[model samples]
Target: MPLQAHVVAPSRTAHVLEIIKGAILSGDLAAGSPLVETDLALQLGVSKTPVREALKTLEGTGLVVIRPYLGATVREMSYEDAAAVYDMRLLLEPEAVRRTVAAGGRLSAAERALERAREADGGVARSAANREFHRALYEGCGNPLLVASLDGLRDQTSLVSVAAWARRASWETEAAEHEEILGAAREGRADEAADLVRRHVAAFLDRLPKQDIDPAPPSP
Candidate 1:
């Protein structure tokens, strides 16, 4: 039987979407896992209607794919997919840091945001916070379009990484990279900051596991 939803609300669809997203990010819903509306509705304690809506939302987000008569399946991460996302980040995010540093002082805000992100270093929530911190930094770049693009790219990237990210030693390494970028931004050196960000993204792309997604059955 599906677990009951903790609360009933007008925004039930959005709530359901968020819960499934959390499940995926926390590795409870691994890639390629079947997502039956009935099963999900039961598990989440919501009616099938909201679950359907939520699945539709996720499909649009590239987090899941809904095939006709096939139901919904969690999207797998391929190296090609990861590379495409990294390419966008390479093209836009570095420039965002450069523009932000060129526009004004954002070092203080970056520091504060980084601190907030680190507050949950070992849990699912921490991954969400960390994504926010980086997005906040890029949002300061003063280009709304670039910020939005990078935001989407980051979300796609997270879908591939958030599951095992909390267990990697590189989490601390990434924090240090953030510090370096912050320092460069603080010194009013946009070029230096861009350089650091560029290399940081490159290094991350190089280290991702090649497995993409496992084909094993979902946990019982």
Candidate 2:
């Protein structure tokens, strides 16, 4: 079955870009998978122009790569690329969490976060929900730039995490780690919470395949 792009407006190419980007981040579209315009246009019921525009937008963001004759594919993550994104997250998100926790008030969202982490489906959905939960924890940090940058980093890290999730045998443990971080945050232990997140992120990055591991390159 072909996937349809849900277009809400004709002028908002960014909206379409977001949907496709979400698809990529959530692991609905795997790395190295080709994006066919005609099929996407037909599926989305939108004109080819918007589809093209959305692809261009993603290409610019480095989420999708466009080639001359081969066309567009989701950008693949090498061990180095994956490690860099996660390492950045390890450096940045803890600060955001600490700042938010220090400025503490209500953490009603944390309850929902725990639930989502526990119940969301394995693999991509779990990772997506986990990312959202982390964002919710830091939404009160009061820095718009931090929030936006962390959001992008989270999306990039997710791409690598999803790929790892699909290939690894112990993928089920990610959800449990999410809950541990959320629990620390919910308790107002900003330092401990940040430490937990740092460790959680670092552990995954440590396991990433080296450049020489050679993923059985996806079929053409």
TM-score of each: 0.86, 0.82
lDDT of 1 by residue, 123-195 (tens): 5665666676667567888878888788777657776557446434456777788889888888888899889
lDDT of 2 by residue, 20-66 (tens): 88778766776788998887777777777888999997876568999
**Residue 172 Cα positional deviation in candidate 1, in Å, after optimal superposition:** 1.3
lDDT against the true structure, per candidate, is 0.75, 0.75
In terms of TM-score, how similar is model 2 to the real structure? Answer: 0.82
Steric clash count of candidate 2: 2
Model 1 lDDT on a 0 to 1 scale = 0.75
Clash-forming residue pairs, model 1: 2-42, 2-43, 3-43, 3-45, 4-45, 5-45
Task: Kindly state the number of residue pairs that clash in model 1.
Answer: 6
Candidate 1 segments whose C-alpha is farther than 4 A from its true place? 1-4, 105-109, 121-123, 163-168, 212-220
